[model samples]
Target: MLDYHFQLTRPSLDTIAGILAALFVIYSVSWIIYTRFFHPLARYPGPFWASVSRFWMVSQIRGAHADKTQRELHAHLGSIVRIAPNEVAISDPDAIKTIYGINSGFTKTDFYTPWRPAWCRYPDAFTNLDEPLHASRRRITNSLYSMSSIARAEESIDKCTAVLLEKMASFAEAKRTFDMAGWAQMYAFDVVGQLFFSHMFGCLAAGHDHRGYIRSLDLLLPILCAASVMPTYIRSLFLIGGALVQPRVMKALTSLKDIDEAAEQCIAERHAQLEQGKSGDEKDILASLFAVMREKGEKVDFGRTEVKVEVYVALFAGSDTTAAAVSSVLYHLMKSPAVYKKLTNEIDEATRAGSLSSPIQYKEAAALPYLDACIKEGMRLHPSVGLTLPRHVPAGGCQIAGAWFPEGTRVGVNAAVVHRNRDIFGNDADNFNPDRWFGPDAARMDRYMFQFGGGSRTCIGKNISLCEMYKMIPELLRAYHIELVHPEHEWTTHNYWFNKPSNVETRVTARATGT
Candidate 1:
């Protein structure tokens, strides 16, 4: 009886294994056939492996040169290139309006899902995928980030700028070649911190990333970019693996927790001030937000969580972007001595004419055409966000770049690719030339500029960043004689979310007056 039972079970196990192996082979062949020949996007051009798997996109992003890779792909494979099985990168200028314009019906894709903070129950304005919800959020927050609001926050910015100048002076006196990128980030963070929380983050004072916020963000961005292209199940598995294998994952989480705690503390302090009748007529973002909440009453309520999350969004979104822009502008200016001299001459003229004040004012800076051109040209050449701003083709589908894309396709425009189009930006599109922004085709060039993005989903912090750049760049140039530490070699960059400069080391000395 025992011998008969053992024999029967062994044969059954063997038969089951054989059946499973056959099923695996069949599924693999079917998937390959579908992806290669039968998929909706199979007609598009891309690397062979990219057409079959998301791994290619992942590899490009992981390599930190996805922006350059996408540009090369567009150069070789026309405007539309299949980056992933279901994703197409569009670089045609005409496609901008179709994909991102108001009422375009192209919603943000799941690629943004990983951008939502782990602490938030609801997605913040930047990460909200649903169009209606995003619209609602944007509507509520629009007033707070408007140009007028940024104008009101200019004093806070000026305070931080003073600190930055003081820090630079110390560097000048010490005759040290400092990491300008780190200093730019510190300046950005301090300015945002002061504007939002009524406190400086003290990064500049500390002369280092004391809270590890920068490092945390640096680690987190790559992970998010990598996970964005992954299948949901696979992404989950990857995250689990990351937690087990990578200590940086935990550091990132801890950094977020620290940020949340700091925000809560700020909120608590504000409430205490309000209760004690010491909440003066401050005009910072926190004050403006509270004013809105008071006016709305119970009709449009904002809970503690909502307020905290909004503050988190302001800090996270505002800091790195402005820093990258600052770094890009400075790097380009250093690279092109002619452009730098032209820009500094503009600043000096403004100062001499008494139109610009010490630390410079946003309004006066706005009036400098050459300064504006330099800022625009720098942003155009090296946009902070390196990856494509992805959007989903809405139901019923739509035409994009003169072709009809089916519903549910992921379409996006990479700024790096679009900005370098020779037809739109001219033959010198790849070169850094501020003159392009001041030419006869300036208006036409403006139409394709995606530095702050375009359409309804444009960056809410655009005015804030402009305010910083417009003021700070002029101030720095006017006060210091700066030179790149390695003028012979080009600086390196690593693109995760922001195309961050890796080695923006520079030596600074105070400029002799009336030179």
Candidate 2:
């Protein structure tokens, strides 16, 4: 009886062990097969490890060394690189147009959904992917940014520009070293507040840095990288669940709440005034938006959630990015004295010739040849958005740089790579040469200097930003000359959808231009 029982149990145990072994072998074989042949990206040419791994992509951002990686990849791969199995990085100008141009059948990738705050009323403002929805939102905001509106808004512009000039003059008079980068932030925040919310954050008045309502929002580069590691559904989990629960994420939402609450209050005040027939020609983006909505006979009450989000999006977008571009241009100018001196002269000459006093006109500032050169050169060398905001190919797939790619392939144009392309800008592409802005030379700027991106999705706020910078830079320089107190100063950078400055430190002392 003992021998019979032992035989029955032994066979059953042997059968179970064999089944487990076979399952393990199947999984191993399937993984190898996927990496070797079944993967859609298996046919693309790239680094062997990169084709099969997500580590390289995440590591670049994780190490805060994306610039180094991009430079290396471009150096090794020429104009086109298959950075991942499904994505290609194109550095050529023609390819940029081919991939990002209005006709290019590419749309914003699903990667942006998670970066959006949960409380966003008009979540569709910046996060929407469908082309028609984007168009509709653009229509609502377009009038506020029109040349006529900006011209009409010149009183506010003058007030803010004057405030900045006065502050710089004080620093120049005192001969004290101050934080120029910090001041730029203050100026930008204040200006954006005045224009968008009909209020001022008073960052400039405070002198020192003030953590305003918008300070908590980090651009979510880490999340973008994590999402890139796997399929779209898996990426959604990281953004929807993982990111929203993080402390930093919560802080950002809180900041947004502050801005929204304040904006809603201000909107209420403006609407009340309008209802009372108190028409004294109020100034601000909110005032104009309210006016437009009223004229259209749309009365759904002011301070609606969507209205608040729209206001926040415009304020946040206008302030930070423009400030960054302006600050970078200033930093580069300080580093290159020849460029600085040249730009100063251009600003002086243009302002003098025009005799502009109250509000610096964009039309006049746009004519400053050297100033234009300096701005273009600065944006090219250090783009605000370092990574190409990834775009998805249409359903039928598309051709980029003469290569046929499958549908839904993630494609992007790396500004860092394209801006430094030797083929278009010549060998000194990396240098800050403002001379490139003059004559037919400026007109010859390659299509690839997509600092603001390209096609219909290009920045809608370009005119407003350029107008502000065009005025602000000249006015600030007119009041005081700036020098970098720490000549060897360096700032940290993070690789988000935006190329965020990390702990950016600088001292701004005033100097005369030896006029």
lDDT of each: 0.85, 0.68
lDDT of candidate 1 over 1-515, digit per residue (tens) = 99999999999999999999999999988987898899988888999888878899889888999999999999999989998889999999889888889988889988888778776756888889888877876687688888887887788999998898888899899999987888999899888888887788889889888977677678777787888878767887787677788887666556666666767877788878988999867778888777766777256556666777788777667788999999999999998999999888888887888989875789999999999998998899999999999899989988888788889999999898899999999999999999988779999999999978788889988998999999998998899988898988888889887888868889999987833
Candidate 1 scores a C-alpha RMSD against the true structure in Å of 1.9
**Which residue pairs clash within candidate 2?**
none
RMSD values for the candidates in order, in angstroms, are 1.9, 4.5
The list of candidate 2 runs beyond 4 A from truth reads 1-38, 43-50, 53-56, 117-125, 208-211, 219-246, 249-253, 256-280, 297-303, 351-359, 439-441, 502-514
Candidate 2 on 1-515: residue-level lDDT in tens?
Answer: 99999999999999999999999999867865786587765655566556655556666666666655777777876656666656666665677777777767778876567555567544554577777667766676677777777766655666678777777767667766665656666777777777775556777777744655536444333554556544565665654575477865445446556655665776677667777988547677776676666565254332345565566566556666776778778888888888888777776676566554536676677777777778888888888777656788888877777777788877778787788877677778888887765536556575567888788777867776777787888777765677777667665566555565533344444545422
Top candidate by TM-score: 1
Q: TM-scores of the models, in the given order?
A: 0.96, 0.84
> Candidate 2: lDDT of 443?
60
